[model samples]
Target: MDAPVRFDTKVALVVRADLAVWQKLNVAAFLATGIAAAAPDALGEAYVDGAGRRYGRMLGQPMLIFTADRDQLRAVRDAALERGLTLVPYVAAMFTTGHDAANRAAFQAEDPDTPDLVGLALRGPKKAVDKTVKGLALHG
Candidate 1:
């Protein structure tokens, strides 16, 4: 049997609990992209089947997804930031924008101190990430 793998860093996504099912999925997908971009090392080697068909790579480590209320989402963002960890946020405005530029503009317009965050993605040291997400339940 293959030995277990461990990661020193952790990736997490926290989505607004009040969002619709579709919205939750959208937020998760978008935020995951940000994590992948920020941490290239997070990705694992591509796969090949028995017939030699190749498949795209995926995260080397498991990503934990958590659901939180609007207030909790803000708190989580703040906590991560306070720890000097980088955060990739998806504001409510991004949903209405179609392109990357518009999405960025919408993000810039929000209050930096308290954004209307629908979701957030973060990658950092395991302990820091764990402390940042403490008390949060896993998303189903």
Candidate 2:
């Protein structure tokens, strides 16, 4: 077998720890899309099965998911920004939003200084990402 490939960059998703199971799942899925949009290069090529059926492409690199409390989530967001990493955030208001426009409006209504973040994702160099998520535990 060949040696495992190593990625220089890391992808991480962090969700507020107190959310319900369904909310966590929703947040994770939304956060992942943001990472995909920001890092198109990370997407692997589409796949075809034996019968020539095509499948959607996925991220070539692994993404770590973590759980954090409100304060911890804010800190992680701050750290990601401080390190100049690509960041995407999902605010609590987004849960009530029915569409993209409403979501945008909800996000916009948030204070620029401190959004009421329910979850966030980051894409950056491995070390920086590590530091940003330090002390967070993997989602169970």
Candidate 3:
């Protein structure tokens, strides 16, 4: 069999630092979910206990967290895109605003105005990710 698939690089989940505590948690969870959805293999398999309890954990790759505001977030997004890095963006309206309203606005709106990005998860070569997120401070 081929060697087990491994994520040999670092992953990052960056969030807006100015958000409320609840919003920070929400953004973190959503950002991680986006990464998990996009790169399931980066996560390890689930575990089972003798009692048939199940637990799951992320494996191989370790994630680094960072904090940034709206302008910084936009800059990172643009830089990542320009560098051809893979990014999963979490929008503020989707989590802070009501879901139905956010969805309707997103789908029904005709204008191309950009939504507010609350968080982002990026996975790729270590150098590329680092370059894309350079100068960003860690989340407090």
Score each candidate by Cα lDDT.
0.93, 0.95, 0.76
Task: Please list the residue runs of candidate 2 whose C-alpha ends up more than 4 Å from where it truly belongs after superposition.
Answer: none
Taking the tens digit of each residue's C-alpha lDDT, what string does model 3 give over 23-67? 888878767776777787777778888999998766446678899
TM-score of each: 0.96, 0.97, 0.78
Going through the candidates in the order shown, the clash numbers are 0, 0, 0
Tens-place lDDT digits, model 1, residues 1-140: 99998889889999999999999999999999988988887899999999999999988888899999998998899899999776899999999999999999999999999899999998999999999999988998
In candidate 1, where is summed lDDT lowest over 10 consecutive residues?
78-87
Maximum-lDDT candidate: 2
Clashing pairs in 3: none
Candidate that beats the other on TM-score, 1 or 2, i.e. the better one = 2
Error of 1 at 136 (Å): 1.0
Best by TM-score: 2
Quality of model 1 by C-alpha lDDT: 0.93
